[model samples]
Target chain A: MATIKVLAKCCGVSVATVSNILNNKPGASAKTRKLVLEMAEQLNYTPNIVAKNLKMQKTRSIGVIAEDMTIFSIPDIIDGITDYCQKQEYQILLTNLRLFKKYNDTYYNKDDYYELVRQEIKKLMEKQVEGIIYVAAHERVIRCIPDNLPIPAVMAYGYSKSRKIPSVVVDDVGGAAGIVKYLLDQGHKKVGVITGKTDSLHAQARLIGYQQVLYQNKILYDPGLVAEGDWTRESGYRCAGELLEKGVSAIFAMNDLMAGGVYDRVEELKQTIGEEISVAGYDDRELSGYYHPPLTTVSLPLHDIGYKASEWMIELLNGGELENAGENVCAVDCMLLIRKSVKDIT
Target chain B: MATIKVLAKCCGVSVATVSNILNNKPGASAKTRKLVLEMAEQLNYTPNIVAKNLKMQKTRSIGVIAEDMTIFSIPDIIDGITDYCQKQEYQILLTNLRLFKKYNDTYYNKDDYYELVRQEIKKLMEKQVEGIIYVAAHERVIRCIPDNLPIPAVMAYGYSKSRKIPSVVVDDVGGAAGIVKYLLDQGHKKVGVITGKTDSLHAQARLIGYQQVLYQNKILYDPGLVAEGDWTRESGYRCAGELLEKGVSAIFAMNDLMAGGVYDRVEELKQTIGEEISVAGYDDRELSGYYHPPLTTVSLPLHDIGYKASEWMIELLNGGELENAGENVCAVDCMLLIRKSVKDIT
Candidate 1:
């Protein structure tokens, strides 16, 4: 059967008008609404009442706001959100803000790009989206949110500085501390920790967690064991190789991609993971499970974070007071996936 | 000055209503419209005409449709799309069809995952998204696309059976072949290939490219020299180690993650990567440059692929025919990133 979409196009009306008429909503001119019905009838458009109810008070939509859409964590978080929303009959409206880098300073700039994005958001808003989920790619608190939105806003993966919204985040500090403690518990006295960009707030928290864990365990924090990576695999390989040559028994690589690199270089030096030297990684991406020795890594609950973020947004939209003074701070726990990569150094 | 958003909220009317009273759109009831106008003055919500014009009929958004959100490619392509779109004042609306899976009778079941995916797509249609970009976690054609969509759609990191929908894909075959050919040119007779998933279209293409390049140059294809991996660094390490036991002189990993794994295993075996067995990888992820002795890889031009996909979707939306019918393929060239991974066998 032809869909209402075809009917809308044939009659030259927005799908919204066709939906309003089909669902018997209050808006829509009688003339235009009559044309939609006629076209739908001729095309045999089957109206889905289940979808109609889901659409009611909802654009049947949600938005994911993120910087750097390509980060590994995004997909899992999105997967979690999508799975939950779809079960509830909701569609997602994705917004890639790409605010990680400066635009005008780069190569291309076009007016159509700006105009089109604004139009899409306005379109979603006009459809009266029930809730909006902001999926930030990093840990930066956004200060430039558009005030044009009328629906409830929520953050996932990253959050805002203001408490006016709710957010879901991984316990970066707790997760990092767990990794460090894992290394120490395995009896690796000299543990090395690689970090992402020092300026990153999440990275900073991880670093603190690593240090605190070591200090509490009675192991003096060694500056020699600290190195930095750009969150790239090569950086992990290089930094870990440099540290490995110094004879550290266990290594903690931040994020799995970098851990992959460290794993590569460690093997290159004739060291067997979990045998000659123990190694651990973070952000248990799916690929991590397949990595050799299957990378003993930390599993960040990305999907749970996204799901919780959306759930919180729904609550906030309904006028519920989220914790942190209407600013929901959701800290999803991270699990350590023990593969063959770590050794019992004790 | 107060924004129109705050003023409209305070006046208990819609932003569109206030905008209508300001822009003089024809359809508002006179009394309510008058109240909106007077309230805007009292609340000092002097409309920023420039911002308003920017917003007028503009959603400042684009929509992204991905197969699985967590794949390695989607986020990067999104990073590129967002980088470009954000600069143009466009935001991205992200949606994932969650369609990448081995289709079977289970998939066709009404409550099945794939069917649920179609239901989600129907919901995205109701949101009135102006355009859509499809991204896959891996490079290949997806089997779960719904029969119809109401907006312009483009595919990235994947292709469509119908040429009407434009797509952007990397030349995995060519890129993999190029790396193998480089090993051949280096005087290595026993070259091994560490492949990704055996059923993956991209993996099959790379194998074809490897065989084509090797046979054309008069080298024999050995089944013993080929190993299959699911494209993880650990798999690479295992596969490479297996190939090493068989005494292959060089290896070509399907992607960078696998290549890194090969390097790790080689080090563990006390065999140097570049000095003993030459290694190469596809997809010049950031770490390829910083790897010890660096790494030799093929560039996938991910961001470019995303940008071009958007451009193609716009063209299709405007009713333009694809440049070629038989060759509707847009294969991005792979640039050889020569690093320390490969060595001269002669």
Candidate 2:
């Protein structure tokens, strides 16, 4: 925080002499330069970029504030963001909030967290970043980005709730529908479903997708076949038995972690998945491939969501209108990975 | 690159008027301020921070160069870096090289990658970061950081091969020895070894650790009991059968992925993992916990390595001598996680 004048006074040298040495300009002898340099360090003479408040302009750098780097969804989203930004020769000034590590999953529910985000935003603004991108660990209605922010801001993997900040999230409805359609096509009329936590938007949308597929097929949707799960492998295992007792030929789990539970239940019943009973899961986690039969699942468009978020940011920076101005949200489609877990009974 | 003079000329205003308008200082009329701002934006005016090169001092920011964020090791490392930095109130300017995505695993073996790193370094230097921390995806003798660099640089999860640039890496030797010692204490004689690729420093160090344990226990080392695995599950499976045939009671896999292969081979023989064949794995990956009986493995000190790397960087920045200045390479200890996979024969 010290100025060159202060450093000069302490070192018994002229301000111009201290400036010359600090700027690497010739004129000061090596001894004077070393003395001035050491003194400058001692005084913490930081020429802060906040000085740019006087004249800061296009930094060609986007400030990315991630909820937590340790979260599973964050890395891929960041990868996608960096991939696109690098292509545009735009630099990334990253700030990891470490919210999850500090507060666990309940951080978002806290009111003070939003204020924390605003602080990070203010710091990035001081650094003169052209735009801002907030990467969330989970998809939810996150109102962290202020509606009246001066610069452009985009949300990745979560809803911002404000029209000013565009949000990019996974198309959970389409993803579940696509996978369920494949399961029905495999000759499974009575397909059991393991739903995620009741409160999750993902769970609700995926259930709608399943109901829509059954409606189109003219099959009466059986509420009995839908067993509640909390998105854990144990919950999936607990729900699978009820569905199997209901005579469903195949089971669809909301996420791969729960699907692993279904496998555990099926194996316990002396039934092999993909043969006696087909299983399909959403979220093709890396562990899904290592599953005994390899799970047939949906891979969330996480990377694409990040890419789209940055695309919207760069567009806004370039003075272009957001592509999803009408809805203010972009839902990226998930890919159906047909591994060995789904059996073709037909 | 547009200067205030150019912006003022374009706005048809005096330089002071333009400066006052851009700096949000009162004096300029609203209409005049709007015109000046519009002209500044049009000129791609950025009050470039590089102008600080004239007198830039302590920015209290460190540049972190990550090889790839998509790698499993990177996020946690970055998390640790952020953890230490936030506590110290220092900012991080992150540059994700995305080397694994661009050049695959062979990037380290390539000649051009070093030049790519130097370019990134230059960009960070221009941003006036006081220090640099390079996070490598894999451990190796990396000479990417130049010795002539003015500011200090630290290597995380890899060796810099430079005394000036302190390196923080996993204590693979100690990690392996600790787990192997646990296995030996369980009354398991004739423990078989499955090593990673021969070229890896991690694999070599781990192998030495296994050997050290055997020698300390007064057990003769047998080359036949050691099987070469290229850090793949398939290779682990291939070697598991051979080690089992050689009549070893327990297997020490170099990594968890390879241990998963051992599980596969054990199941093929219609035997339960812990009951029939005890297994201890390295790098306690997330998937290892999901493995059937779970896995007993060594948890790498990735987060600690990152924390130590930043500690070294801050020390160098604060003019404090590095604690490990004598060795220049500080190998942080790994934690032993006991899960269901390893059985006590005693």
Candidate 3:
């Protein structure tokens, strides 16, 4: 409850010196800064952000509207957003729509959900949030944010498809190419692909990555090697059976869940994952590490996407030019997690 | 941005009528109310909650300090908090202290981390949040929240151990007892137990639950059958081998990750789970469903804990008495998810 003057007097320093330390301005000596901060902590001094922000018309707060918190990718992304915001000393006003809990995976395509989002945005705007970040559960071209929004908006893990509202998403094409290249490097000539829903942006981009790697390696592209999956374990199992029967030396299931399915099918066929047929997966989910031989997969840069989105949101708030890797969309790269699943045939 | 007056004028209604409808008060004709609301929405009218709240000296916002968003338990708990807050028309000012990311698992016992929590709470208080809700990553006796806080503080998934601060935690004892009782009812006389780290409150409570069920069934408790596991899959595997060798018909691993280890050992020994050995798990994690025959586990009421914490926090804000199911603690019950992992040996 102590003011700057009281904290400074208690610490035997000038009020300006104490102010510099509290504001993290680089004017105070290290020893003096430590003394002032420790004293401030002891006195329970908290700057009234609400009163200050009201006068300045700057809340130093970002409104983060997550599609669903319970989803696998959302937490990590939110973590990234928080990490960035913490460094900037900005607080987040979180609006969890709980879409999955209410609609059970069917809410993503619903027009009514947009109305819910609009209402949340208005509520946040009423609270004087400087900007908004819409965190989607997955990658998709979701046009949820209205074009005429007063504040700057950034989309994480989904495309806004507008120049004004930038998007930060995973580089699925590059990630898929890297895994397929790794499989090819392991002396596998025939590598079968098990994809997520064909209409999915992730699936399409990953397929392109696969094709790019094959092209660079001077291998002819075979559409027959590709199997359509609805991003389910059962679908992966069915696809794995067909791929194995076709005599492919290795298989690449788009996600970790599907890779798990491939493992199940391989086990039923009385063959080990790494020995009989090399396998790879995408999305380094926690369960992937528990997979028998473990899964060689790509770890989605979900956190980076969130961080990037925050960066863009703040940049826009400050009237800075938006930095985008491609046409106002930033594609964060995924990391390759090498485990025991991929066999070195050569 | 149309004001209430402008909206009312556009809808051919009085300002009082518009204000009443907006505040959810009755007496206005349904048709007139619909016209006013629709006109308001079309004009992108947003209420200035900040200015109004400043006058009332009450912000309909709760400060949610999550230990770590990336942790499995955190997102669902936050979701529950957000769900309750949304219903109450309250917003959450989130401060995710990336404890796990910063200090890994060791941060739980660090005294310095308490300072970080205190700082965050002070910041939230400065922002004029009505109350504070601390969401822990896992259940532990975390004494991070200050004993003498200005605002009401509620602990979710952890014990605050303060009479003033109501703690909402999972009913580990009851959850453990329910699973053990199910195993006994299925004719498994020789049951084995794999416990988490001995010092954990959850592990200790669960052990007591196991003892209670055995006493209720008039079955003699065997100390030798209880194997110690550090809540790791490797520990689970090691304990499973020891318990199976001790001639136990069924094993209950304290967590799903440990239960997966039980399955690993069973497979290695060429014995099938749910048939040769009826296995059960606690913490019905998502990965449990992907287990060979899936897992019959106790689903921790993580969301329920968040919901209960929010209820108590808001109740306190409204000048209501603290309602704790136990002494300063409310233990939410865990749901038993019936899956194929548990078999009917009778």
DockQ of each: 0.29, 0.24, 0.65
Q: Give lDDT tens digits, candidate 3, residues B111-206.
A: 879889988888899998989999998988878787898789999999886777888999999999999999999999999999999999989999
Q: Pick the candidate with the highest DockQ.
A: 3
Report lDDT (Cα) of residue B246, candidate 2: 97
Summarize candidate 3's per-residue lDDT along A1-346 as a digit string, tens digits. Answer: 5566798899999988887888889988999988988888789887766766876878899999999999999999999999999899888999999998777789977888988998889889999898999999999987878978888899999999687789999999999999999999999999999999999999999999999999999999998899998889999999998898899999999998888889999999999999998899999988898888999999999999999999988888889997543588889999999999999988
Q: For model 2, what is the alpha-carbon lDDT of residue B234? A: 99
Please identify model 2 stretches exceeding 4 Å from their true place: A1-56, B1-56
Q: Taking the tens digit of each residue's C-alpha lDDT, what string does model 2 give over A54-101?
A: 345556889999999988899999999988998897878889998987
Q: Which ten residues in a row have the lowest lDDT in candidate 2 chain A?
A: A47-56
Clashing pairs in 3: none
TM-score of the A chain in model 2? 0.84
Each candidate's clash count: 39, 3, 0
The candidate that achieves the highest TM-score relative to the unseen native structure: 3
Off by over 4 Å in 3: A1-45, B1-43
For each of the candidates, the C-alpha root-mean-square deviation to the true structure, in angstroms, is: 7.9, 9.2, 4.4
